[model samples]
Target: MEVSRIRYWLGVLLVFLAAFCFALKGVLIKLAYQYQIDALSLLTLRLLFALPFYIGIAVYQRKREPVAPLTLREWLWLFFLGITGYYLASYFNFIGLVYISASLERILLFTYPTFVLMMNAVSRKRGISRLQWGALALTYLGILIAFAPHIQFGNQHNVLLGAFWVILSGLVYAVYLVGSDSMIARVGSQRFTCYALIAATIPVFIHYLIRNGFALLNYPAPVYGLTTIMAVFVTVVPTFMIAEGIKRIGSANASLVASIGPVFTIVLASGLLGEKITALQLLGTAFVLAGVSLIGWKGKKM
Candidate 1:
C-alpha cells in the first residue's frame, strides 16, 4: 500500500512537471517572435534542436529493447501521426501565435482534451459518459469565458483568424492522439515517440530547406539559445515525462494535470509577453481546471 501511494504521488509530480514544461512552449514561442523570427524558421530551429535527442533515443532503444523492425504499414502510420500531431499541429500553433496573444492560443489549444474524449467515444462506438460530457462543457465554457473579453477588445478579423488556426491545430493534434493510441500499444510508448519524432523532422527539414536554404547557421545567438531551450526543456523532456506520467497514473490523470498548462501559459504570457489577464480569464481558467479535474476524478472512479 505504501509503495502504491508513493508511486501515485510520484506520478502526480511527473505530470505536473510535464505540464509546466509544456506550458512554457507557448510563452517561449511568443518570446522567440520578439527576435523577428518567422514561424517556419522558428519551428525549424526547434525541430533541428529536438531531432538529435530523438535520434539518440531511437539508437539507444534499438540496442536496449531490440524490438522487431516495424513493418511498412506501421512505419507509415507512425509517419502520419508524427506529421499530423507534432509537425502540423506545431506549425499551426506557431503561425497562429504570430497574430494571437499567447494566452488566447493556450486557451484555444486546451480544447484538445474535449476532442480526445469525443474521438475515444466515436472510435469505441459508445456514447460519452455524462461526466465526460459535463467536463467537456465546463472546459469549453471556461475557454469562451476567457476568450470573450479578448473578442470585445482585439482586432476582430485577426483574432478570428488566429482562433481558427489554433482550433485547427487542436483538431489535428486530437487526430494524432487517437491514431497514436494503437501505435503506442504496438510499439512501446518511448519507442513509438522516438520513431515518430524522427519521422516528423523530415517535413520540417524539407520546409526549411526550400524556404531558406543554408540560412540556419545565420541566426543570432539568442535565437539559437531560445530554440535550444524550447527543444530540450519543453519538447523532449516534457514529451517523455508525460509519457511516463501516463504509464503511472494513466492518460486521464495525466491529461487533467496538463489542463493546468493554460493557466501557466496565461500567467507567463502576462508577465513575459505583456498579455493582459482579466478577472473573466481567471474565472475561465478555474472552470477549465474544474472540468478537467472532474474528468480525471471520474476516470479514476471508473
Candidate 2:
C-alpha cells in the first residue's frame, strides 16, 4: 500500500512537471516569432532539432526491448496520429500564436479535455452526467471570461482568427488523443511516441523544404538558439514526460494534474512577454480552473 501510494504521488509529480513544461509552448513560440521567422520555418527548425533526439529514443527502445516490427496497418495508424496530433496541431498553434496573446492561446488549446470527453461520450453512445455537463458549462464560461476582454480591446478580427486556429488545434489534438488510446495499448507508450514523432518530423521537414527550401541556412544565431530551446526543452522533453506521465497515472488523473498548465502560461506570458493580467483574464482563469477541478473531482467520484 505504501509503495503504491509512493508510485501514485510520483506519477502526479511527473505529470505536473510535464504540464509546466508543456505550458511553455505558447510563450516559446511567441518568443520565436520575434526573430521574424514564419511559422513553418520555425516549426521546421524545431523539428530538425528534435528529430535526432526522437531517433535516439527509437534506437534506445529497440535495444532495450526487442519487439516485433509494426504491421502496415499499425504503421499507418501511427503515421496518421503523428500528423494530426503533432504536425498539423503544432502548425496551427504556431500560426495562431503569431496573432493572439500567449495566455489566450494556452487557454484555447487547453480545451482538449472537454473535446475528449465529448468524443468519448459519442463513441460510447452514452450521455454525459449532470456533473460533466455543468463542468463543461463552467469551462466554457471561463473561456468566455478570458477571451472576451482581449477580443474586445484588441484587433477583433485578428484575435478571432487566431482563436479559430487554436480551437482547431485543440480539436485535432483531442481526436489524436482519442485515437491514441488503442495505439498506446498496442505498443508501449515510449515506443509509440518515438515512432509517432519520427513520422511527424517528416512532414514538418517536407513542409519547410517546399516553402523555404535553402532559406533555413540563412537564419541568424538568435533564431537558431531559440529553435534549439523550443525543440529540446519545450518539444522533446515535455513530449516524453507527458507520455510517461500518462502511462503512470492514467489519463484522467494526468489531465487533472495538468490543469495547472494555463496558470503557468498566463503567469509566464505576463512576466516574459510583458502581457498584462487583466481582471477578466483573472476571473476567467478562476472559472476555467474551477471547471477543470469539478470535472476531475466528478470523474474520481464516478
Candidate 3:
C-alpha cells in the first residue's frame, strides 16, 4: 500500500512536469514565429521531427505484447484524428497565438472540458452533478481571472477570431480524446499513437507542398533544431510521461492531476517568460482549478 501510494504521487508529479514542458511549446513557437515560421510550417516541423519517436515507442510496445493490429476503419479514423486533432489543431493554435497572448490562448484552450461535458450530456444523458458543475464554474472563473489584464476593450475582433480557433482546437481535441480512447481499447495505446501520428503526417506534407512550394529544406539550423526539440521534449517525452502517469493512476486521478496544466502555463508564462500576472488572473486561475477539481471529483465518484 505504501509503495502504491508513493508511485501514485510520483506519477502525479511527472504528469505535472509534462504539462509544464508542454506549456513551454507555446512560448517556443511564439519565439519561432518572430523568426518568420508560419503556422503550418511550425506544425510541419513539429510533427515530422517527432514522427520517428512516436513510431519507435509504438514498435517497442508492440514487441513486448503481441497487440492487435489496427483494422481498416480504425486506421481511417486515426488518420483523421492525426490530421484534424494533431496537425490542424496545432496549426490554428499557433496562428491564434500570433494574434493573442499565451495567457489568453491557454484560458480559451482550457474551456475544452466544458465542451467535453456538453458532448457527454448530448451523447448520453448522464449530466454532471451539482457539485461538479460548481467546480467547473470556479475553474472558468479562475481562468478568467488569470487573463484579466490581457483583456483589451476595443476592436476586440481579433480576440474573437482567436477564441474561435481556440474553441475549434478544444472541440477537435475532445473528439481526439474520446475517439483515441476508443482506439486505445482496440489496438493498445502505444500502437495507436504511433500509427496515428505517422498517418497524420500525410496531410502535413501536403499542406507544406501547397503552401511553401517544396522549399522546406532551405531554413537555417535553428529551425530544424528547435523543431526537433519541439518533437522530442514537447511531443515525445511529455507524451510518454503522460501516458505512463495515466497508466499508473487511472483516468479519474489522472484528470485531476492533468488540470494542473493551465496553472503551470500561467506560472511559466509569468516567471520564466516575464508575462504579466495580475491579481484578477490569480483569482481566475483558482476558479479554473476548481472546475478541473470538479471533473476529477466526478470521475472518481464513479
Cα lDDT tens digits, model 1, 150-234, are 7887643588888889999999998998889788888899989888888888998898899888898887788999999999999
Q: Order the candidates by lDDT, highest first — what do you get?
A: 1, 2, 3
Candidate 1 or 3, higher lDDT?
A: 1
Model 2 TM-score on a 0 to 1 scale: 0.95
lDDT string, candidate 3, 1-302, tens digits:
99999998889887887887788777777667767778888888889888878777777777887766667787788888777668777777887877766666776787777767767766777867787678767766776665545555533447767767876887788777766767778776667777778888878889899989877788777888888888888888887788788888877777787777766777777765677766776677667767876877776775
CA RMSD of all predictions = 1.7, 1.6, 2.2
Select the stronger candidate by TM-score from 2 and 3.
2
When summed lDDT is taken over every stretch of 10 residues in candidate 1, the lowest stretch is 149-158
Clashing pairs in 1: none
Clashes of 2: 0
Q: What TM-score would each prediction reach against the true structure?
A: 0.95, 0.95, 0.91
What is candidate 1's CA lDDT for residue 197? 84
lDDT accuracy of residue 131 in candidate 2: 88
